[model samples]
Target: MKKICLIASLITVFALSSASVNAQYYFFDGDYYENPVLYEAGVSVNAMNSLTDLGGKKGIGEKFLKDLNLGYTSISGGIFFSVSYKNAVALRLEGTFGKVSSDDKILAGINDAAKNRFNRNLNFRSNISEVAALVEIHPMYIFVDWPAKETTPPRTSPYLLAGVGYFSFNPQTKIGNRTIDLQPLSTEGQGFAEYPNRPIYKLNQLNIPMGAGVKYELSPLVNLRAEVVYRKLFTDYLDDLSTTYIDPALFDKYLTPQKAANAKILYDRQIVKVAGINGKRGTEKNNDAYFTANLKISVIIGRERIRR
Candidate 1:
């Protein structure tokens, strides 16, 4: 009986040892793991547009492609710097340069909203540039391989980002053979002692950027990204239209004789209105916002992740 017991114990030990050697264990354990710095630098091309009181139909604003027709889309480009950890979190420094514009004239024959907008006939173009610092979170770990490899992560990921930035803009418009800078003119009664309520607006302001995106590894060292981001602004004058029309004469008081005439013509292009009355030109209830669709390519370089 003693010999039989000894044989049984030996068989059990061998079986357990074989299983331990053959079994698969791919997940990380509580053991010390070292995550090293990973860096990526990239350039992007984006298409951008703005939503303001100047353009779009009078109703709940539609988003994405639905509102594309309302905005005059423009092209932009920028560079990005990134530092990532375990492929889960990233800090990005972004510098973007772009232009945005809106024209009420585009509304012609589109809807009744056009009539009011056409009569208002306000249009503007602004060159904008900004630098932002953002944090990104990627929640789901998607895999390109059945078992993740050491020093490698999933080939694709989706992430969300939010951050604040400072931006500068100069609004301008083409007045036939001439180009007019709109901010100095204060077309909507801004900076007038008579309309003391309207304060002069600054060219530099803050913006909050929020957005989501997906990334794919085109190769071991190269990645591709497509993202859509919207920047919320506190100022309504991005397009230089945010308040009531001032007496056209105010232009003469504030600008040169030649500039005064040009400002008056650009201020109120109303094809139709009560001849004697200057109406509320725009609403200040809501601030302006802009969105961008970006395509980016990046190269990944860094120390490999290690676990022991």
Candidate 2:
């Protein structure tokens, strides 16, 4: 009787191990796991913020997050399409459009480190449009969950993404009741023969997008994701403000009389122009950057399942 009981226990252990192995090889519900390729499409809404030379922390100016101001945050949205293999890797193509703005007027006070910026009195708003191709890697699938004997994909997955993108922007400022485009005014001597080094900055340029996010499998056919992505830009003129203030006369030489008039006021909005100080317009050391926090919903659009 003792030998028979031992044999029964050993058989039970072997059977359970075999069942776990088989579970990994099959999708209990259907052929979703057997699918060799999966396709998804989605849309996202985001809150956009700028890290430019204007509008920064309340006191001293700083770099990166220290200068972030939610007062200038704007709305943005986009759509994306993706293809994935075995839920481990994905390639996504996406396009987004949004607006970003900054104003120096918000920083006002005597004896503050930001007083210099407040006195400069510069401001701008821009429309940003971008398209990118990104690669996403799911480490959980590769390292932890792929071998699990689960009948479904993991409910949550963390991912990392990096991509290349092309974007366009046109910076604008308001003067009186009228709105003005800054590039043509050459407010800082851009494209001026007098300032040979200050070449025209193209409205369109390339950017690098990098960030991380987590995705939740809401259902077999749907997923939800929350992500934050920062765009690395090559140009410092996103707000049409970079480098020191040019001689006001340069504007009249390079632009029409009407534009020159607007440039003077738009360039120097200071209540009282302090004499003997060559004004600094914006910091040239750092290029502008923008980021977005997005909530996205995606639906599986197509799949190719392997035949049993």
Candidate 3:
């Protein structure tokens, strides 16, 4: 993570330096009618958690799961540099980083044997990180003007943004004497039994980001922004858990009657129930979603058009 952060910082610095050199050619030559350079930094509070009892038979109750929710409301900060052209359009480069967690009492049900087998404690704990970049457009701001004479300034400017970003996440769970990886729990049945003493998962994913927000200009050079974004991930194992109990009919198809009965006992305490989209367990789907809200402050670096 530190290496990734260092690389991001270098990229941002290079971009700003390159932009500064290019700005003189466009602005000094009077080739553009309007050009406003902006730089911003701010912090955000993230209320991130999951809905419980998402899908199963003999699963955690919906209300109990919801109430046992655990996660972090963290303050994330970022820096953005952008340029507005002709007052009608703009382009921005932004990088944001924050910490998020998924802790819940649902982990408490795992027995000592299960914990030893999976190498995780199953207790609620904070363990995750996030980073993203976005390209934004300021459409409605074309009609709004900054107040130059007012003692109190206007506090809002609505805008919309859509873009793609790369993300890296590390989710972990505690078992007994050691902390184990949970992302692999989804596919544990395949080859996990062989490695009973090691961490089971190393889950990582790429995220697709999109959202909208409003900005308030605090001064000619500084502004505040509040935005909400939904991230669509390419993986289905964010929770690093699963519920795979065998139904009589399901077992009848794959196992002999005697084997089926034994399998029930083996899985009785092994499966982790996940609620479906419709609030019922054992439905067709078994995936989850992630969302976030960010607040930021930015500064205007330079804004002036020179005569050719």
Candidate 4:
């Protein structure tokens, strides 16, 4: 009986020691799954472009890459702050700045079906700035970046995001040495007696932004990310080409002599005008859209448990 008691005591001590070692190992190496919520801050630079009725290749093609018009790409950046929930979900607020531009004159050989656009010869560039609150969901929420561990999650994981934002845009055109704002010109006879149906488009509008991305855990505190986000804009005048042309007489009747002269030149730069009251200045089939390809880096800021 004494011998049996000794054997049992020895087994108990060994098991206790093993459990203690494992507990210490996980604590020091970040191998455990339950983590305190973390706060992170990030910054991103964007390559921005748009697909309007203007300069892209005529055929409807790739949404992001194939439709990319390099000439119209603009460099942009944004700052973001996020609260991450143990590698599962992150709520972030980000603000971005970029520019988008296109010119119908950039592409040649307008088909018979597209001749109206060829003769239209419209172009515009707009400065785009937006602020959004987005939620990022990680399908594979497990992150295994630490060394010396048997784990299932990979170093990188894909995520999806959707959100709403408010944006401001002002479309401009270059006529010789001067830059002109297209909105005030009322080229489509907006707010005029002849075309009351066409109202002045507001410069600021709402947008639905959605996209997918992948993030790579580069270190305990840093992550490398790439994402493509597209915005569905409420306004179609981002390119300043959204409606049919109006008669030159309307501008003269509505504006001062000098202003009317500028409108005539800026409204349409076409070499030859298609005779009609409402020429195809732009396609009304769809609203304008823009997208950004982002390269970002995020640094874990506060501790796992943020103190209120």
Q: Each prediction's TM-score against the native?
A: 0.79, 0.86, 0.55, 0.80
1-308: candidate 2 lDDT, tens digit per residue = 34334533544454344334322244524655434345678999999999999878778778889999899999899999777656777777788999999988878764587887777778899999988877889997767554355646567989999987888999999878888999988888889887788899999888999999999988667889999999999999999988877788887777889999988878777766763224677788999999999999999754334468
After superposition, candidate 3 runs with Cα above 4 Å error: 1-47, 50-79, 86-90, 103-126, 142-155, 184-187, 190-202, 242-286, 304-308
Candidate 2 residue spans exceeding 4 A from truth: 1-25, 28-34, 145-151, 275-278, 303-308
Candidate 1 lDDT score relative to the true structure = 0.73
The model with the greater lDDT, 1 or 3, is 1
Candidate 4 per-residue lDDT, tens place, 214-268, comes to 9897866788999999998887778877778788899989987877888888887
Question: Where is the poorest 10-residue window by lDDT in model 2?
Answer: 15-24
TM-score of 4: 0.80
The CA lDDT of each predicted structure is 0.73, 0.80, 0.46, 0.74
Candidate numbers, best TM-score first, in rank order: 2, 4, 1, 3
lDDT per residue as tens, model 1, 3-101: 334533544454344334422333322332223345678999999888877667644344434544534889999898777655666777788999998
- Candidate 3 lDDT, 114-155, residue by residue in tens: 232222212222333455555566665465443233222244
Which of 2 and 3 is the better model by lDDT? 2
- Model 1, 221: alpha-carbon shift in Å? 1.7
Q: Evaluate residue 188 in candidate 2 and report its C-alpha lDDT on the 0 to 100 scale.
A: 81
Please give the RMSD of candidate 3 to the true structure. Answer: 10.4
Looking at model 2, residue 282 earns an lDDT score of 77
Model 2, TM vs. native: 0.86
- Best of the candidates, lDDT: 2
